[model samples]
Target: MPQSELGPLKSRTPSSERAVPAQELRCGRRLSGWVLAALCAALLGCQPARADVCPSKDIRNNVTNLQTLENCTVIEGHLKILLMFKTKPEHFRGLTFPKLRVVTDYLLLFRVYGLESLSDLFPNLTVIRGNNLFFNYALVVFEMLQLREVGLHSLMNITRGAVRIEKNPELCYLSTLDWSKILDSVEDNYIVANKNDRECGDVCPGAPRGETLCPTTTLNGHFSERCWTQKFCQKKRCDATTQFGEVRVFAPFALV
Candidate 1:
């Protein structure tokens, strides 16, 4: 990946001062804070993009462009860092978006082979409003072959749309979260084809009272795991309380 650091903001010399060459040019100096605001707000999407602003288009690349998002706190659009191929997890180890708090649209991660977890990359992300979605889903993590976890530890709410996480061969920490804690409904969400929970050594620690952390339900009618993570797995029983809010957390036969 090329080192594409953000360029320094330039000062705008007024047209009236053009005749005075001595005063008209002042290179290397940046505009004041108010002028910088005008530079972005006055000509939105124009050149010399703000270091903290997300790209106007969907974010994509093999490198994830961690450099471009130097001070970003809120991504107004979808946040999709994808297709980081032929790389190891450590390439992005020390790199992170520590200031990011919300992705107003959706978030998707696909074919990121080296990424083992998201705990560091988006450590402060609290909400994904899902104003826009990818195939009717707000969060999609697919084909992450080496990923071991969906480690968004600070994620608190996904206010709209469903989740789709599939085809992650080594992924864990899926059969532990209770989506009911975040989403209004888990009926349409899909979580499948990750490492089998039975074989996954990192299976979620059950509830504190020695009860099952999550209700027994088939993931997309196959893998016998329910919920999304351990923190979301607060409800410990699967009897008359099998339903976590509006989510039917058990197969019809299991409920029988």
Candidate 2:
């Protein structure tokens, strides 16, 4: 037969050669699948359970009953934090707990929504961390009547929870580098209001009255006119012709 027409004989060196590549591929696929499965399992394991986030108005008394101690952080007994609604329970005012006595060790924080100010609500609670806290636009004092504790570092408000800081634009009195200074400034402003205006409409009978009716000045009244004229108008305005022009010209500027 011609050499060109003859084909090479099938190599029969070993049967193992034919099966080895397929076996190696099968082993590689099995190993890849196992690695993939392990990676998937690991990813799922690290995810937080739905139970971790408490919803609004759903009060869970004795939270220790719900999850294992390991799953929940134990601050004192079994409760780590008691989540209260800022508004659902009643718009950030605070929950009315007549029988409430928070254990200091077990409860980490009390998160409430719509907090206009954080002064009195958590008087005993020195530290807090949450989302959705409204700035205290109407707060003057931080009255922690039963609290002598220390350390208030974790206090904060966030986006979606009872502790969220939102909707409080008029809370200028509560924030300052020196809160005492801020309090002093607020007190000064309050005194100014009380001095010029009759708040409860209770005029002080013992108040010092000059010649003119000074106590009659309300917050929106001409207070300086009564005060200045009452004290020194007679001594200074004996020359009425000389004073009228001066008084009239400077009257607009005095209004300011």
Candidate 3:
């Protein structure tokens, strides 16, 4: 070898001398894995720690059976109450979900015997974020023979579905509820059908007969008052005294 070409003999550094520590390299890999997992969870809206209380199951309208719902605060899927032919109405009178705040899917109440009202059942339920499997309604009440009032008094929002109230023969307060006051917006996505027609006449005098009348525009602009009070004014012109007078007159002329 020529002396000029081989003159520079710099000290050789081993590859191991520049290598990262094993423990630190392993920790870096673990940190990267954790970051990727966190990003995936956020994008998928994963709720791994919170399991569903009632995962797409039906709850028969039996008092003893429904006690399963007493401690459930959130239902990740549907909550269906149906087929209470053997149960009495009073048995459901005590059924309440004081802690329930949200139903991630739908809440269905159908063919419940003797269920007079829902006002007391879900008093604290504030939201129904529907990820429903069938229809788009977050809440469905159908064919409840004795259901008189929908008692969702504290319900403030339904994030992604409609509302359906139908075939509840004795339900009377549907026409009076100002749904816009409770929900963010009804958006013309409701179905109120096959309820008691005579009560409908008494509650919503001018509303069309035997059809869905949800988001009833003829509501007397009140939250819980009777709609018949303003029915005459809605149908025909009347003086202020006649409209807002404390004295009320029925068709058969009963004064109160």
Candidate 4:
């Protein structure tokens, strides 16, 4: 071959230019790794955390089951206490959750044989952000035969659902609680049924039928119908009447 045609062996291409492809390859690999890690993080963030189901078989023998429940700040699913026949109501005397703040789903107490009241269980629970599991009820207490009180004094909000108190024959205070004060608005979403009539004042003396009669009184020659006709009436007070006729009677003071 002619020397001119061979062209001086193409003077070994410059090292810097040769290194360009290698550099680009290394950068591509690094970018791919970063992208993969970012995608993984995004997926993890989108997924809901697993729920904590309490009252395991060991609950009767160990306090750890209760401790597990206490440790959760947010429960992603239902918090159900059902069929707890072994654990008596007295056993729950000291079971309190001081740090629990939210339940993202329904808080159900169903047929818990001995659970008398939830008065002390979750003292700090402030929110039940319902995920729509139990037909729009964030808190459902059903068929709890011995349950006497719906002790949700500290529960201030139910973000997305109603409250259902049913078949709790002994739940006497159901008529007295001011549900509007706790929830943002009741909006006719509360259902209280199959409870004790006398305890609920369903039949107070000289009261209209079907009305849960609270104590009546006369103030300053006025007949004030202090009754709890509506289930959500927080305070038991005599309803104001147009009749101002004077009548001698003894009545208790109705505190607000």
Candidate 1 residue lDDT tens string, 1-256? 1112101101111121111111111224433433443444456643332224454234455565656666765676787776667779778788787767667678877777788888777776666666666656778887888888887766656766778787889988765566766565777777877899778754444645566655554444554334434544323321211112111111110110
- lDDT-sorted candidate list, best first: 1, 3, 4, 2
Model 3: lDDT equals: 0.52
Q: In angstroms, give how far residue 171 of model 4 lies from its true place.
A: 0.7
Error of 2 at 236 (Å): 50
Question: Can you write out model 3's per-residue Cα lDDT over 1-256, one digit (the tens) per residue?
Answer: 1223212211211121111121222112323323433544677654323222555657774757777777766676778887677767777766787766567677878777887766667765655656552344567777788876776655655545556676666776555655554443566344455565454544443444553333335454443332322232111111111122122222111111
Candidate 4 has a TM-score of 0.52
RMSD of 2: 35.3
What's the true lDDT of residue 145 in model 4?
86
What shift in Å separates residue 56 of candidate 1 from its native position after superposition? 4.7
TM-score of each: 0.60, 0.18, 0.55, 0.52
List per-prediction Cα lDDT, in the order shown. Answer: 0.57, 0.21, 0.52, 0.49
Two-way lDDT contest, 1 vs 4, winner: 1
Count of backbone collisions within predicted model 2: 17
Worst 10 residues of 2 by lDDT: 247-256
- Model 4 Cα RMSD, 1 decimal: 28.8
Error of 4 at 166 (Å): 0.6
Backbone clash pairs in model 1 (N, Cα, C under 3 Å; residues 3+ apart or in different chains), count = 3
State which candidate, 3 or 4, has the greater lDDT.
3
2 versus 4: better lDDT goes to: 4
